[model samples]
Target: MAFLKTIREVGKYFHDIYSGVASLMRGMKVTGSYFTRPGSIVTQRYPENRDTLKMFDNFKGELMLIHDENNLHSCNVCNTCARKCPNGSIEIIYKKVEGADGRSKKILDKYVYHLDTCSFCGLCVPACDELALKFDQKFEHAVFDKRKLTKVLNKPGSSSKTTNE
Candidate 1:
């Protein structure tokens, strides 16, 4: 009876080893197949194919303020984008000036954007009721100086068309 028990233990050990080996082979089968078929690789050749690379329309790259051909923007300086920014990445500097209509209104002086602190969450885009803020597909942001990441969205001499008019 003892001899029979020893034989059963040996058989069970071999069965456990076989189960482990089978599981390992099942996992390696995928890797081996990919290795054998090199053409199945899906990685894109970047930088080399920069000319042909077209980013999707919905791809979020950088925050931008929409400007017309006249260099005027739609931002009303309502502070909606600044308030909606999760990381405090947006800052709006404005001044109240007397318009030709004799009414004091806010004029956008500067729209400071800190790209380093931005999480690219895109909350600021939709938060603007005026549709002023948006994400542009300009993702190649590699730079040596971190200070260069900071941007002023409004161009020089550009003013908000909403109140200026």
Candidate 2:
């Protein structure tokens, strides 16, 4: 019985070793394929191709609020995006005001976005049921000062449905 237990343990150790070796070979095969392909270079030339360098559609860049031609937005200040963000990157400051219908309504005071804290999770864009938020393809986020990262999305004289009313 002892001999059989020892044999089983040895077999399990060998199995683990084989599995590790198989994974290593698989990874090495991929690396070898890439190494052999000189024309398959994927590195971007950056500033040289700045004018032609287009980011992929799925690339997450700067978070922005979509506004109409008249500087009107659809954000109701519902806080859905702020709540869904894994990091506290979005701060929606809203104020209650009397609407045109005489009912109290909320409007965006400041749509503060802290890009420094953002994880680029893209959760906030979809969480916004109003479809007021989106990510742009402007990848140039390098700034000398960290304070520049914090952005207020609302443009000057911009107003939402409640505020416009």
Candidate 3:
């Protein structure tokens, strides 16, 4: 009985040692793989690699209004994007204009996007029924003043060409 008890204790000690070595090897295996794989290296030399760096197609950086080839935007100024914005980042100001059909229509005067307070939750893009809102890939939006972050989305003097066409 003494011999059997001694053998069992020695077996448990060896088992614990094996488990510890296995855990260590498993961790080292990941490190070794990363060290061997060139593509696994994700360090980008900033400013130097900026010219060649490519952003993914689905990467959402900032909100922008989509203008057609005719320099016309499709926003009807319904204020749906502003209403859906959780943080009051979207501020739209429009004027009621009488169309040729004698119907009063809301024309977009200014579409202000406050990036300083924006959460970028991406709800405003899908909330727009006219597909007017989209995400632009340009991410360099740092500004010295918080008020400068407030941008008007539309190009000046650009009108709704499709509507008038």
**TM-score of each model, paired residue for residue:** 0.76, 0.70, 0.71
Q: How many clashes in each structure?
A: 0, 0, 0
Sorted by TM-score (best first), the order is 1, 3, 2
Residue-wise lDDT of candidate 1 within 18-60, one digit each (tens)?
A: 9999999999999889889999984666655677768899889
Candidate whose TM-score is highest: 1
Top lDDT: which candidate number?
1
Candidate 1 segments exceeding 4 Å error: 42-48, 140-142
Error of 2 at 99 (Å): 1.2
Better of 1 and 2 by TM-score: 1
State in Å the error of residue 76, model 1: 2.1
lDDT comparing candidate 1 with the true structure: 0.89
Candidate lDDT scores, in order, read 0.89, 0.88, 0.85
Could you tell which candidate, 1 or 3, scores higher by TM-score? 1
Please identify which of the two predictions, 1 or 2, would achieve the higher lDDT against the true structure.
Answer: 1
Among all windows of 10 consecutive residues in model 3, the one with the lowest summed lDDT is 42-51
